[model samples]
Target: MDEIDDSQNPGFPPPSPTKENWRNQYYAYRSPSGEIHYLLLSDFYGHLVKTSEDVIGSRFIKKKLQTATIEDKNEAFKELKPHALALMKDKFGSRVIKSFFEHGLDLQRKGLAEELFGNVYTLSLDQYGCRVIQKALELVDMDQKIKIVRELDNHVNTCLYDDKASHVIRKCVECVPEEHIGVIVSVCVDQIVKLAQHTPGNYILQSILKYCKNTLTQKRVIDGIVSSLVILANNGFGNYVVQCAVEHGKPEDRSKIVEKLAENIVEVSLNRFGSGAIQKCLVFGSHCDRKLILNVILGSTDRNEPLQTIVKGQSGKFVVRTLLKTCDDEQRELILLRIKIHCLEKYLPQED
Candidate 1:
């Protein structure tokens, strides 16, 4: 065989031993502004797709997807389609996928959503993939939103409890249309207490209370949580679920929560987290319930020892301030008097 050295052929460039050297062989050019800018010899989109698995390459693709022209972004999406699932599961590639959903053209976004249609649940449950699913839910149209929500229909509770998947489930509750919202609510409602007590699941339940617009559905959620009011109120994450219930629950539901807390006011008020729930009660509880809470804190007309103890503590001070803001004039005077007597004056603002 005759030896042919590529370096001897003027028309052909010598091959580099490694891909990194080959990539570096492409050089930076100085522009009219005197700034050096690197340029790619091959199509930028094609280069990115070829090296999509490389960390630096994937980030470049994400940046281009973010700042590129719509036409260029469409081309990038087409190039990445074949590896969509794999990219979605890749830590770096997932970000590129998310950027496509965020900045791609309408057709590009729709096409990407369609491609991920059947696998929405799987993506929503994967740590990196869940992020892509969340972006789609926020930016895609209603029909696609319905499709994504439907994929999650069978796994609503499962996603609610998973650390990463819970976020997607919450997004679905917030953005999906009413019909799809009904599907999520129906699956989650019966498990409200169980979900509320869970670390991540509580977030999904709170989203249900915040976004599920049907008055009847809201009531059902409230009724479910209220049945376990004390337990939820005392829980670390469950307390926020209680707070959301009070903030969004019906008037009657709010009263029930207030009554439950009132029964254990001092105990809850002294808790590190439960105190916030009690303060929420003061803000949203009925006028009568407010009076009831004050009575429990101040004791009878003669003694204000509980009020003294609460104002002196950390979390309880916030609850006491909330009380001062909402209390009637007579109630306010009594609370102020107790503050003065206890010499916890520093916790209270001095009148101007």
Candidate 2:
């Protein structure tokens, strides 16, 4: 077939599937006499394979020439416009067929599993199409399940660096049964620590760690066990997640696990330097440290200045109110009198 003409011949009409000129069904034949033959233009098939090199650009012209050829230059030019029109019509139909087949395959897998399992199989897992495999395994043969897993593994491996793989793995882990959680937990934690160690903002690793929060033991002693694992895996990593861990040690028991963990550092300071860990606590934390500061203010003879600082800090409403309400009558009266003296104006609530 000749290339498309680039000269002033009006370009071929836009492609369409219905227009016909030559062989339509894509079949070309060789005669017994060693001559090549195509369906005659008289047949619908022949008309369908029409060539159009004169009107379109080189690429489109080349593609059209793949199936047939033109005998006369004038007839070929006449054919070119219709050929381009047919290409446009065929393109949409081809795309629809492609998408239909793809989605059909997915649905077939789902339907087959549902048929076999009746109600037992549930498509719950999240690994590369593993949910389909998980559902299918319940009803169909075990071999089919293995095939599905292997196929999914291939696709997943190809996308190791893609953002979606991390999410897919987390979903896979969640869909895993409780009996298998321990194994998945260990692997996830190890991988997360490794991936996030260099750059702490690694979203995937951070996601894995956040998910681990659900798996961690809530018991204080057991929490220590988990804390040890975290430290060993992620020691010296000073990211927001680590800071989160510092705050996370508080269990309902509130047995002072933080104090227990840091006691050695505090003790080494001796009386001269006081407790180093406690000092750090004062610096790093404000909520729990407020109690210590309040005791100091209450015990001091000249309480006006310290009380004024607490009032100006605006913690006096919630914190001071709760403290007074929880205290003995004498202590509550002293606080109220102090508030009357130094903080009466700010006590009024502003309306929105």
Candidate 3:
């Protein structure tokens, strides 16, 4: 044991734990052998209070305290069993009755979930207490039973207070719904573009573009999402934005997007260019859309270049075809020939 300090000692009257303390507690620590160690053994309220400074021993003390609260687990189950059984009376009644089901859930009583959800078709909109109901549902594997619980998890996030719990519940709710179609994606392109002006993450804009690609309707909406994804691609989310470009039905734009992505990824010519997106564009979209990709390749040559290279230092089917299509016969043969020559020199050797 270590020496202990009195409550009257310096740094005494340790600050009480509040939401602010909760945030700061991640970095705080308690003296393991302190006189206040016993206080760690208090109930949930006490655990919250004692969590001011994180201590290894405090967790064991808290767990012991929780266990101590339950006297004769079977008897506890018996006491709460009647109300749990009554939760299946009617939809509204079951929803309301689920609250009393929590005590039995914590005890992990047998057959409790089937007893509660056998009659209810939906979870209560009041999800604050739904956490316990959800835990109980895990024991019952019936489709209808799971569906009701899944529906509850999907919309419960808006009402739940805990962020992690909200995320988890939402994920569970992703189970196949009886009439579920894929998410009906609608992207506010203008909103996404405008938001990206202030936001740092390009993934949001990419997400919009992805929605447009998958939905493949509302041309104006797709254009907006594409433009936003492209514009934000100048930021860091290059691969995702390029994905949106490749997925767009308009075959004409594929090459342009690929070249731009490849250019930025191969070389860091422009400070604003995102290298990761460019690399993916070269690897994935170069072949699918090479006809209109010359602008990106030529753009890389300007002294005022906006990107580093048009190909990601690799040769592939798209790269070979792109080189072959460098210039038509009627154009300046010398200039076109030189471009073809250099491109072949750069790409063909690797393909071989």
Candidate 4:
């Protein structure tokens, strides 16, 4: 026989049962040649674990699972379940398991959820495993959702800061019910200021504020940020949390942000991130609040030093332009008259 080129795209049906014995199944299977291009659901019979670990093989199984008949899917599940924990952590296997969670039978999901019980926290911290847990949380029943999150109960702070695991915490805040996230929210409440300053933890705080409106928990988080708004706006990372407030918090809450920032307007407008918050005040603050910001921009001292100081800084100059765009015509004229020299320069924006 002529040599069979391994480079050829060779497709192998999933590992088939060996006649030698039941235990011989795993050992009897020999590695097949070439790149796996296509695998049918029925083809996933015995080699499920092997294929689930392969890059192309696992992707094929996931695509097949979506439209495969229930019986074929059950057989694949039987072969895949025992290795579920390991697969959940496997690079490609995790993707296959998530496909099952998304497209497999409801009953099969419960079985996978059982395999994930005590390992949720460890898995949530895994780069691949965290994704599997997130999908399970979305598709599993309430009991499973509670069980999965309960694993992270006291560990909320860790997951909140972890690079991979933080996504799981965010998923919980987004997908789980309010009652189930009390621990997560309570932890955030206690550590609101510190967490808002953390780059990763800030997102968890943002998710709560964005999704949990009207809940007392959201109100407390908002109040916490509002009380510390000035400090947060000045922080390099914490400014994001302050912007979250203007985007998600209530209308009156925004006015409060404008009022609070205006108290330190000159200092804030000169700083980088702090100036961003001032721009938000221009767009989101109400008419009365905009007037407040305009007055601050006009300044109080002889020669209006704050106004001149603001127009010269890089971020502060853009803020001046934004304020001019947002303020009333009368306020704009007063601003234009005071900056008579700047009128000839690019310090001010041209009218559209």
Highest-lDDT candidate: 4
| Per-residue lDDT of model 4, residues 112-225, tens digit only | 999999999999889899999999988999888988888899898888889988889988988888788889889888888899898888888888888776557867887898
Q: Candidate 3: minimum summed lDDT over ten consecutive residues — where?
A: 178-187
lDDT of 2 by residue, 8-116 (tens): 3232222332223223443233444444444333222223333221222222233333333433222333433233223322433222222222223444334343332
Task: Count clashes in each candidate, considering only residues at least 3 apart in sequence or on different chains.
Answer: 0, 20, 4, 2
For each candidate, the alpha-carbon lDDT, in order, equals 0.78, 0.36, 0.39, 0.81
Put down candidate 1 lDDT per residue, 1-352, tens digits, no spaces. Answer: 2222333333212222233432343333344444444543234545555456656556555555666775676667778888888888888778878878887888888888887888988888788999989999999999999888888888877887899988998898889866666777887888887888888788888888877778888778888887888888889989999999889887888888888888888778878889999989898888998998998898865658788778777778888988999989998998888888778889753334
The candidate that wins on TM-score is: 4
TM-score for each predicted model, relative to the true structure: 0.83, 0.29, 0.36, 0.85
> What residue runs in model 4 are displaced by over 4 Å at the alpha carbon?
1-39, 341-344, 349-352
lDDT of 1 at 308: 77
lDDT of 1: 0.78
TM-score of 2: 0.29
TM-score of 4: 0.85
Q: Model 4 residue 100 lDDT?
A: 93
> Which residue runs does candidate 2 get wrong by more than 4 Å?
1-162, 198-352
Return whichever of 3 and 4 wins on lDDT.
4
